[model samples]
Target: MWTVAGEIMGLWSRDIPEPNEVTFTTMIGALAQTDQFKEALELFRLMLRKRVPVDSVSLSSILGVCAKGERDIGLCHGLSCNAQGKQIHTMSIKLGFDRDLHLSNSLLDMYAKIGDMDSAEMVFVNLNQHSNVSWNIMIAGYGNRCNSEKAAEYLHRMQCDGYEPDDVTYINMLTACVKSGDVRIGRLIFDCMPSPNLASWNAILSVYNQIADHREAIELFRKMQFQCQHPDRTTLAIILSSCAELRLLEVGKEVHAAAQKFGFYDDVYVASSLINMYSKCGKMELCEHVFSKLPELDIVCWNSMLTGFSINALEQDALSLFKQMRSLGFFPSEFSFATIVSSCAKISSLFQGQLFHAQIIKDGFLDDIFVGSSLIEMYCKCGHVHGARCFFDLMPGKNTVTWNEMIHGYAQNGDGRSALCLYSDMISYGEKPDDITFVAVLTACSHSSLVDEGLEIFNAMLPKFGVVPKLDHYTSIIDCLSRAGRFHEVEVFLDTMPCKDDAVVWEVVLSSCRIHANVTLAKRAAEELYRLDPQNSASYVLLANTYSSLGRWDDARVVRDMMSDKKVLKYPGYSRSVCKNDTQMILENKQ
Candidate 1:
């Protein structure tokens, strides 16, 4: 159709000695509509060179073309189009069309779209009259820049100027809220709307999802249903994600039914989300059923299935599916490589992991941060810390996760000095240590018996690094002290720790006490654990074992009687090993 239109315009230019303003206007508008932006601008310039009087319609059409072209080229190369738009603006004022509301609004839109909000504001301030569109353009401009405060100010001004915000206004405000992650403000804005459209509902739902408030997202989804608002593809996908996060299988199945009813079950995003929801719920059969039923699968759906297998400890199956995916002509994305590499790590398949690493290098994803981090973790988990360090050093760029993985690799391999040195380098390189970094470092210190160094690091966590210690950090420090036979210090530290009531804290303390033969502290730790987590049999067993090891038969028997009275039966321990032929064998302790 565009080619036909261009041929006719060519014939007209050849046949007619001079095309009138209407002729040029019609041609330029047609080109702009078809996304022939360069052709549209060339024709507009031709009209000027022909000494033809450019009308308001022609100017508005050209401005629209410039705005769209600038946006298409992105902000980096938008200056040229911005220069042309300003020239058009100057020409509009000279032609006495500056006061024309439509022309003025077009100029405003062009400025805003080009990211020249200051010029947009200038054009807006000079306008004699304002429409809802004018106000919306300004609000949306600020919203796009993530300046939510300015958008709110304009929204208030629009209301004060006797222009009730339409659906567009509210939706734009919600978009700002989504960008800024202000759920409270987003909900207030949604509630203030007399009648929110489906887009509005989706916007607020996204806001809740962005901050990981999945429960609220689900609750809002229910409210949306009660209001009789039909769920679209996006609505279903968002709700499914919330269900996946909470592992709400029953709720997820209901959403699956809703998707079928709405005829959105085959939508790619919705299908992938269904796979993910089932996978997270530990329903591998249901996950497989969803995957097999998909008639057409995109990379996202395949990645979802691979992730399911990895999370369910079916690493061999995941690898087989990966091979099948490639054989079927689906190009693996970075996420695909990351998932399979993680699976290899889970099963300690160093040979396969190295093969994947070679493939990652060949496929040019070696620079990808996620893939790099996963490779590091895989090497570390497969008992190859040096291999992990080699990859860590070769990477051109590194984020906090990359740094943490290498440090954790060293820590897990019992190289405390190397982990601490890498941690110092991380700080020197300006990467802030998060809670996980501290856990790895403290664990390294505990395993190496660096008691004084561990104490110094723990004490500096709050004042120096601004990271308030959590339960895991406190537990790591306690274990470090307990390993060094500093029971007095451990007791004092436990008394002062904020998470003293947590079962995990007491459990660690009890385990350490039993190892160090502090029967009195072990008893106290056992009682705390019993109060915190009554169903756990480890506490009772650990306490009884402590008594037995110390030649106190009466105390051990008493503890065993208490356990029997409480009906806390200890389950037999078991070990799993993968055979050479890729099968699992479980060995249960009979004694």
Candidate 2:
């Protein structure tokens, strides 16, 4: 009642007069109710500064806010919520609520949300009372911290203490499995559950989705139907995400039909997932149709629709929507700007990219690290590699992707020296190079013919940074040796690769053979490439071009006829000024 009266009084009261203990707590409640969590916290601090008596009621509401804001809270925005949680704990003790179990539980939860399992355990230890909720919080805390082993340890302890596992307990344990990406352990826990509920199944399915085990996610959804557990909106969302990523259009359409039948399409999250799925599958028409059907749209929905257009190479459509989005009185999110900037990069539109760059600055998202990275990429894609480097240097921070983009830009612009130097600096600055970084630097080495440096970097990747080379690495080295006309080195390197039949590397070798007019090697590479990736037109074109260079018209005609038989349309030609890396492959035999 006091809290209620304080809320009404607060709206009308001028000068915001200070209140007694009851009214101070009331004002805290009123602030919290209005979602003015920061203000509520400020009032709590004022209560302490003015020496007002504090109690559990005010502590409970404020603690809940701090707990939920753990990820979101930052020192720059205010006192770190985690730091504030500790401060509030000190206040709780001063006010004689230290022994209050309910307040202590809230404290334990706050620590857990911050992934401070040790502090949570300390609270759990000193508490004179324990409940299943307390145990569950601890287990869930470890899971949130990705310390699945510790979560399992607590599960064993909880069961030994005669607190038999309930549905919630099992859910937390499975959540640990999900965090660890251990399908086996999650399956074991699910099988032992006395009765698994919908959330429990969703949790496991979500794990599969997170790990990109899309096939398992699809199978599990089918099993859910067989077991007669009605899949809810969340279930549909997760399954649709899997379908979108895997490009399983048929499965996604079936789920879409089911969503309409069950009315889950009414849910914004479900509808958004469907929009994303359709765009990923290259069905922009469906993406637009589903988006237009929404009763209302939020910023997230707008971002999704714009992202769909950008990723599908519909830059013009994305720009149209961007104009429409702002006209609807919705501001673009940082992600929205980043996605549109990426679209500009894709289409290599320098003038348009500059426009978005100005807009990002006007919108005050220039400081967003992702938007900054996109600006670098946009400049690089527009053929201004030096400008890209300038943006990269100006940014306050650089993630691996940003570093890779700069390195790639230098390599593409034929500035191998700068690319290599930037890579060295990336290590000096302690930003770990990932597989993409290796690909970029290796390509840099190939472009500059820095063979020894490239080899050393490639060899050091696994030992120094624990990055394993994928097929792209193999193809890059082949490109390096092939361009340098080192046929012997190429053959030796090919022998060292795990598989000689790697279609991409063979294609690279074939391309090199075509450039060097090494008919014998070209024939060998073409035969192997055709055996491995027969549908690829580049391999046949390379072989036919090599034949034509040697004045073997019949052989060249046979290859062209083969393409015609396979119904493979030959690509149009490129100007000789194109980048040397991909230019050879996309060339035509214009005899």
Candidate 3:
């Protein structure tokens, strides 16, 4: 079709001495329809250069092309397209076509698609007439920008103006909810639909997935099927993602079969999703099979397989695949670099991590937050806190994760003062700390025996930072007090915890009791741990050791007898090391 259009365009240009308004408008619309946007723009310019009379139809067609072309080229080039659109708008006003309904609507759509909502609103408000297209464009534009409030306001205004909400309006509203993560509002919008279509189902399912409510997404998908709505490629892909998050391999397989049945198995996105689902389920063999069977591979497919290898502890395999990808001239995305860097961190391959860091810098991904965060983690895990700090300081932007990594890195390296100072700086910089930030700071206090400081931070968590203390925060505080031989404070804290029965808290107490030879507290902690984790030998061993250290041989014997009666044997400790070749070796303590 494009070839025929091109041939006809060539003939028209050569054979016609001077093309009139109708001929120019027809050719411009045809070129735009075929996605020949540059040619269409050129023809419009040629018409202007020749001083051909521009009609409302021709101007509208050119505006439509500008809107679509702006979207395709992205914001940088969209600015140029937007300027050209404004120039055309000026021409329309000069020619007395600005009041033309079709041309005014075209102006509204052009401004909206170019992300000039201010101009779009101006065009919309000044128009003497409104159409469904005008309202839908405004709603979709605001929705795309994640301004759900504005989109909802537009919806209300649209109805008040005597225009009934249609399927497209509801879908746009649902999309706004999806972007804003307003799950309840999304559900309300979806439920308000008189009869939702496949696109609507997919949009609502995405809402659930976006919030990590994978179980709800799966249930909604089941309901969708019950309503006799056949799954499309988008549906299968969203459900498969939900399945991956929940590690529901069986459900994922069902979605995979559905994709095949619907003849969407070959679609690049669906195939990539299958690989991701299998990879996340720890089914690397299946992931490999699906990847190998793909007739053609896009960048997404390659990245999925690389992530699968990294997650499955196949760091060497991931590195090999990454090398192969680069060899094949497949440009690595930020995700690809981040994944490989993470694999390097897991295996403690500092040399390989440094190589990848250089590659990331060379590829100009050094500024990407994800890649920068990964580099920080890799350096920290490789026992290079200085290197991590260098990257952290050089980062032009830092999110909560980036700060958390650097603080945790310092905490792990026993630089508690530095970690706490960084946390203070984070606060002063106006970066809102999350739960993970508290955990990192608390852990720093624990390692440095700053029990008072740790407790103060924990107390201020909800009030100052609006961060609710989770189990890890509690664990860190407990560890901090216990390490300082403050058993009374530990007891008081444990009693105040909502999850007092949690075995991890008792384990921390018991370990500290063993260290300080507090036989009574050791007994209490051991009993709780025994009840919570039966057949585990750690609690029994710790209690017996504490008793024996205080010369209570009889009590120690009794505890050993209890362990023997329960038939619980202590497992040997092990240490892991990574070789230069990226192979992991586990050394077990025979003692």
Best by lDDT: 1
* TM-score computed on alpha carbons, candidate 3: 0.79
Ranking 1 against 2 by TM-score, winner: 1
Sliding window of 10 residues with minimal summed lDDT for model 1? 580-589
Candidate 3, residues 126-192: lDDT per residue as tens digits?
A: 9899888889889988888888989999999999989998899999899888887778888988998
lDDT for residue 208 in candidate 3, whole number 0-100? 88
> Whose lDDT is higher: candidate 1's or candidate 3's?
1
lDDT scores of the candidates, listed in order? 0.89, 0.84, 0.88
Q: Which candidate number would show the highest TM-score if scored against the true structure?
A: 1
Give the per-residue lDDT of model 2 (tens digit) for 311-387.
88677789889989989899999999999888878767777788899999898998788898888888987788878
Predicted structure 3: lDDT? 0.88
Order of quality (TM-score): 1, 2, 3
| Over 4 Å off, model 2 | 1-107, 114-116, 119-129, 226-228, 517-520, 535-537, 544-591
| Whole-structure CA lDDT of model 2 | 0.84
Model 2 TM: 0.81
TM-score of each: 0.87, 0.81, 0.79
Give candidate 1's total backbone clashes.
0
lDDT of model 2, residue 510: 86
Q: Rank the candidates by lDDT, best first.
A: 1, 3, 2
Measured over all alpha carbons after superposition, the RMSD of each candidate to the real structure, in angstroms, is 4.2, 5.8, 5.4
